[model samples]
Target: MTTSVPPADRRVPEAVHRRRWAILGVLMLSLLIVVLDNSILNVAIKTISTPAPTGLGATQSELEWAINAYTLVFAGLLFTAGLLGDRLGRKKVLLAGLAVFGIGSALAAESGSPVQLIVFRAVMGLGAAFVMPATLAVLMNVFERDEQPKAIGIWAGGVGLAIAIGPITGGILLDHFWWGSVFLINVPIVLLALVLMFWLVPDSRDPNPGRVDAVGVVLSVIGLVLLVYGIIKGGQLADFTDVKVLATIAAGLVVLAGFVVFEKRSDHPSIDVTYFKNKVFSAAIAAIALVFFALMGVTFFSVFYTQSVRGYSPLQTGLLMLPLAAAQIIFAPRARLVVDRFGNRATCTAGLLIIAAMLAAFAVLDTDTPIWLLEVIFFLMGTGMAHIMTPTSVVIMQALPREKAGSASALSNTFRQVGGALGIAVLGSVLSTAYRSGIEDKLSSVPAGLRHTAGESIEATLGVAAKLGPQGKALVGPANDAFLHAMHVTALCGAGVALVGAVVVAVFLPGRTPDAQEGKEEADLVPVAEH
Candidate 1:
């Protein structure tokens, strides 16, 4: 593989660098809005549940749908949207996505029913589909080869910042306004982003773009949606014999299998199967998926442990997550440097080991576990996240040609989202089953009245404890212990997954730096930004 350098004049041109940074700013702002929107709504769930017009009254799964619906649609459509960016102009599609996202946010804010909010959230996901890949495609086009790693690192950190601020922003909003205010928050930021894009960013597209494959889009969406639905519904699917869940999952696999066959045969495919032929791309995708798999597991149980088990308020729960965010902020830039010095394989393997160790640390938690120790674990998790998120994106985008950057980058994002969704579904199922069974075993010898109430919910049981005075509260202790034990067990399950992922990376990722191979393949393909 041969590596060619841009002419010194082209590499160092002041005007070109300024314009590239300007476009990066626009893409960063757009992504900030998208990432913030994802997590901001999380903290508002309680507010929406209590006093909002679209309150989730008595349906736990519907409550889950409020969050998972957007994720499901976002994950489902990403592949199509990425391919569309290749066929259509990235800038045109991205601007359109911004407008759609703004509209969806407004619709969600004004929604009067849970169903309407869920629908609008899905619409936002649709817009997100276009926005995400377009951002990277624009960056890949704009930045020179040598500059991309640092630029992508900064870009990844910006995403981390949005994640950090989301819950805090949601908390502050909830303190002052209705739950709808969270959705309203996106409108103004998006308008500002639109204005900046018009003034600063130039339009760019792939010159020899491929044809749009409508069939691939359909099969991909159907398959992913059904797969996510089955996993999410697993908790509520009565006795594992629920026909709807089984059928949807079965159909999803069939559709995806068909999609593979279709893509392989099609003259113009949306997802070019040949991209996976690159070892760097394949390994990077695996690493990215596993990172979120671990992260989503942490997110799911942390809230439950902090709130339901320890009786922390929503604000307190948000505060507890702060260390995780803070660690990312501190380590992300450093992670990029590490990757540069040690190469992807060494750096990524080390990082995954850190993550595995951190996940395992959570397995030892007990009612008497020290608060300081918990904070330390959260901090380590953030550091591990820095390693996982920062280098993986850079690796994946760098591995592909500029023309295929959007579709390649989309896979990175898609896997993480799908992994998170699956992690929550599967880990949630494990927690629910373990908690229920533990609660049942503990209540065997308790009075009949208490036994009946134990089957209700942890919240209901706690409420009952409050009413029955001190003695009643003592009876609630074992239930809390059982719940915490279940959480610890779930965390160990995550550690196991991370360990497996770490081993996979060590096995498959090339022992050498990937730049020489990448430089050869992309030699003829100019960046989209350069046009």
Candidate 2:
């Protein structure tokens, strides 16, 4: 019902324009909670794996499901959520999302079983699906095109802030309170965000949102669910070549292909699939996905390496991750300057290579590797990520017209979530297979009946060792060694993935030019209808 730039260049609403900064702050607050929840959960993984009263005693696979359930659902519904935000109203969708997120947080806090936790996590993901895209959409509508990059830089910085805070906060909660407190803490933050949003945030929506692509939505979700199930199952069983796994994975690909075909053929597609024809746009999306694939996988296993293999407590592990977050906070906002000088291709490729180097560095780390060296790797990794996320994001968002802001945001995030989820599943599988093979012979002293269980994961092996007392202590060293080997294999795999991403952006993203820079500067001089 309102436009910041009208046909005659009418004066922008003073209320909307004046409150832009405040609205940004509120949007960042919302973003922080969604990001914080996951980062906090990372530190709690080891705790949640412990038995009974103190923890949930969930298996490594179960812990992965808990995390992936959120990601899968978030990825699955994000496009739909974005469409709804564009159609219904960003402000309304945001409020609804925050409320659902709060309720889901409460439910997750009270979950009595791993199954319960996974389900509630999916619910949280559903809410998060709405929250993530809507926040970006509202920001796009409120900020002037010329200032959008700066605003987005700050927005990306908010993620870094959450990464810095989530772990330490979770650590403090775990040290003093229950594991659930990590999630329970979201309640008050959600409440505060809701109140601020109601007062400061303005509503905006596309005046003519087309009809929903119901069939396409269903196909995407089903395909994703099947693919992820297949991957997770293969990991859980340590047998990817199994008939069931192959069939499920193939079916998922087929369904996804069908969805794409239907969308291309449909009159009103959910996404303008043709945007991918732009080499720069497609390349940018690939960059986002590949970077997250590597980052999330590394993050998933780092906690275990620090806490389980190196004997750091949850708090210590949380503190250890600080260098990573600090580097992001320091570098993310300033990355645009680097891009201005280097261009997107050069900047992103350099960042990915740095990340790859850091990941490969993990291959040499051992139980006694100096802690400071680990910190350096974390810092470098973060520095790489800070650079990669910003410019790639700008490319993806700018590639689409302003009206499709919600869809653009959704597409970027969807690939990110999907990439991250697949990374965890695939890399986790590699870790499992490698560890099991390394430690299988060592388990010969154990009874045949329990050998499979002991070989399942480091956590499981340790649990069995503890039950055997002195005998168990003997298994501890071997378990650590096995995990180290697995980490080496997994880290190398991640490094390879990052290297692939580097090649991708280097090949496809455009180099710097005077015209491109001038266009960016003059973006706000006039508004044009894209279609």
Candidate 3:
């Protein structure tokens, strides 16, 4: 196999360089809104599942769709959007994405039904697809090679900022306004991001962009939709063995396999699969995927644990998550220091192991567990993630030529989203199945017609019980018990996934290289920001 050297390092243009930090602020604002919408929705899941007037009266399965819909569309279209950002101007695409995202947010805020909400969320996803990858691509273009790691750390920290802001904002809005207010909040932020983008951010693109790979894009979307749908379907039914579920999942795998073959032959592939040939690059990518895979699954359940089981208000639940966000904010930018000391393999491996331990700690939690203990777990998990994400992102982003930054960013994020989507699907299925089994016997006391629905989820059971007046009070205890049991099972599974990621990093990700060790000595003398 022939090896090719990476392109020469890019120099930041004098004009762009002068106001780089200002441009970063605009980029972060754009990104925060996209991430905020999702994190905000997590707190609203319980609210949206309530009957009409207060919410859209969505089922547990429907609620999952509401989330997975955005993730699915966003993940499927990310690569294409990245390629577009490369071919077209990044600034032009970024502006369009903000506009579309704003429009989608408005529609979502006014959605009268769950189906409308799901469709609108997908619309939001389309806009976000363009926004996310473009931000990193633009960052890559504007920052110097030596300074890239620090800038990316700040960028990753912005995700932590979004995580901190989203749920609290959603909670405050929910306390005062209708459920739709959570979505409406995005509009103002989107507007601000657009205005600033026009003023501050500069346009950049690949000099020699390729033709759009329409066929490959189509196959990827189809394959992902099919796979996720099957997993979700199995969860809803609590039966993975069903012919429909197995058939849908199998078809999805087949189509994805076909996608790989087709991309290999194409002159201008949307995703260059050959990048995986670099073991370090592949390991870094896999580390990102698994990190999100574990975290997303745990996050999916944590909201319910705090709000439904522990009986906290939306605001309190959001507050409880602060430690998690705080940890990320504190450690993300500083993670490079840890890498300098221990190398990527050690730092990332330790991070993943910390993540695994924290995930497993969920097994010890119950309704009466000390709230402070939960906070500690959240803080630790965030710390681990910060260290892993910053280093791995630097590795992945620097792997290719700077011109391919959009595609590189897209590839990194595509796996992250896909991992998160599958985490929700697979671990969600585990939770659903376990909850159903644990609650099945207790559900018999319900009206025969409602037994299946009551067994669907803790939320559905509680909603049904609320309708039963005084008779409904009896079901609350059983529902909480079943949910806790399911959570334990799911958390253990997430921990296992994290552990696997740690092993991957240990095996394939490199230790300290002589070049990096020398670079660290110089980086110590001059802070990255000064560059």
Candidate 4:
């Protein structure tokens, strides 16, 4: 006897099934723009901060704001944006997001001042907050259970692709065009996504949408913004003992604790706190965060190592980074097959361990280290990242109910952004402090005025060297050596963080047999009553 399929089981239509791949292409295209925006600004920072017709002459703090503005707004609003997508409709939210992002990009391209650029970047972040979660939510709705792992793998790989390509693309544009070209480049991509989404994507929303949790929204936004602000400030100061920094951080933590208490008591909560109770789900989140923490920290330092210390051109540095990107692209799609053959526990644990080893290897690097050896380490690091990222994302999504896809996606992406921000702040502080001390030790013979400039930063040191003629030539070697020393110190710390993350995964992440995972998926697929 044949069993009848319930209406809930029939939620996804045959047309959606046939067009699913096309839908994924459009979704990934949208994702690419958002992810690319995250890293593309890094290459353009120097160009934008230069004086006159070609640039804006932004101060160091203003330059930092230009970069941080986007991330801060993006992180602060992600959960709220996710909830809106779930309640209002994912496709509609995505379309609106694209339009807003496009507008923001155009305005940023025309920005006349650093303040204007920061404001425009924040607007783009608002748009990204809407676009990001909707992409994964739509993907979850369109793809069947069996196809999700592969699709998620491809989606995750887009992030790696963006990281690889953003610098190259930005470098090329900066070489031939104005600094604004970087922001303007996003316009065409956003427009293309908008048109395709309108034609191909279907609107999907939660059947039993909760009332807008105004209190929860306010609390989450305030808490996240304050927390990120404190972290950024703390990193900038590199002084945890500063009263202002301590007060800001303590305030943020207290408010976040209140947010948690409020969430638990709410009848119609914005996010279900119960998801964290699942060991696998929580472990997956932690792994993703820690991996990104290491990845971002390394990437930040490597850019300086390649460009400032080694003196590679932006385009050349981009080319040098190719191994990392290539490995991620190659391995990300294959991760699903590996997970199917092995298990999540083994795959994730091994990946983190490999990353830790690669990071430790980086700690020993010096000015004399072979370029090829660095490339090999990057390739291995990318491989480790792909293995961890794709599988963890798949497991996290699979563990969640379909109705919670928007929130879950936002939560995952939030962790990633937070980890990246913290990595840049914390690791950057470590690098800066070590480099400053080393530079001071070496600058004792230099003039006091020049010595201060040299100790300000590697860039400032190089600038001082350029002005000092023969004495400048003498300083270059010492400056590069100091920077390299700092890079090594930071790498050692990153390796320790990765090792700790591996231990967490080994202990908390569950091993899954194929039968067990299938059973869990079936259980998660139970039909809910239509609203």
TM-score for each candidate, following the candidate numbering? 0.82, 0.92, 0.91, 0.85
Give the per-residue lDDT digits (tens) of candidate 2, residues 366-436.
99999999999999998998888878877765566655554565677778888888888888888887888
- After superposition, the stretches of candidate 1 with alpha carbons farther than 4 Å from their true spots are 1-23, 46-55, 58-60, 83-88, 110-113, 140-151, 241-244, 277-280, 340-343, 393-404, 440-479, 512-531
Better of 2 and 3 by TM-score: 2
Q: Give residue 391's error in model 1 in angstroms.
A: 3.9
Q: In order, what lDDT does every prediction score?
A: 0.71, 0.83, 0.83, 0.76
- Report the alpha-carbon TM-score of model 2 versus the true structure: 0.92
Clashing pairs in 2: none
lDDT of 4 by residue, 1-531 (tens): 000112345467788889999999998898888878756776666556456576786533456567667876787677777678878898999999999999999999999999999899999988998887778778778877667756766775677778889888877887888989889999999989999999999988876555667787677667766665675565445466788878887887888888888988988776668889888889998898888788777877787787776667667777777888898888877886788778788899999999999988977777767789889998999899889987787677667766555456667777777677667666766776677777887787677866754674566676667767886788888888888888888898888898888998999876766677566774664221100
- The 10-residue segment of model 2 with minimum total lDDT is 522-531
Supply the global lDDT for candidate 4. 0.76
Error of 4 at 41 (Å): 2.9
Which candidate leads the pack in TM-score?
2
Give the per-residue lDDT digits (tens) of candidate 1, residues 28-123. Answer: 899999999866765665445442333433122444566667776787677666556666777787888899999999999888877888789889
RMSD of each: 5.1, 3.3, 3.8, 5.0
Give candidate 2 regions above 4 Å deviation.
1-12, 15-19, 140-150, 397-406, 515-531
What is the clash tally of candidate 2? Answer: 0
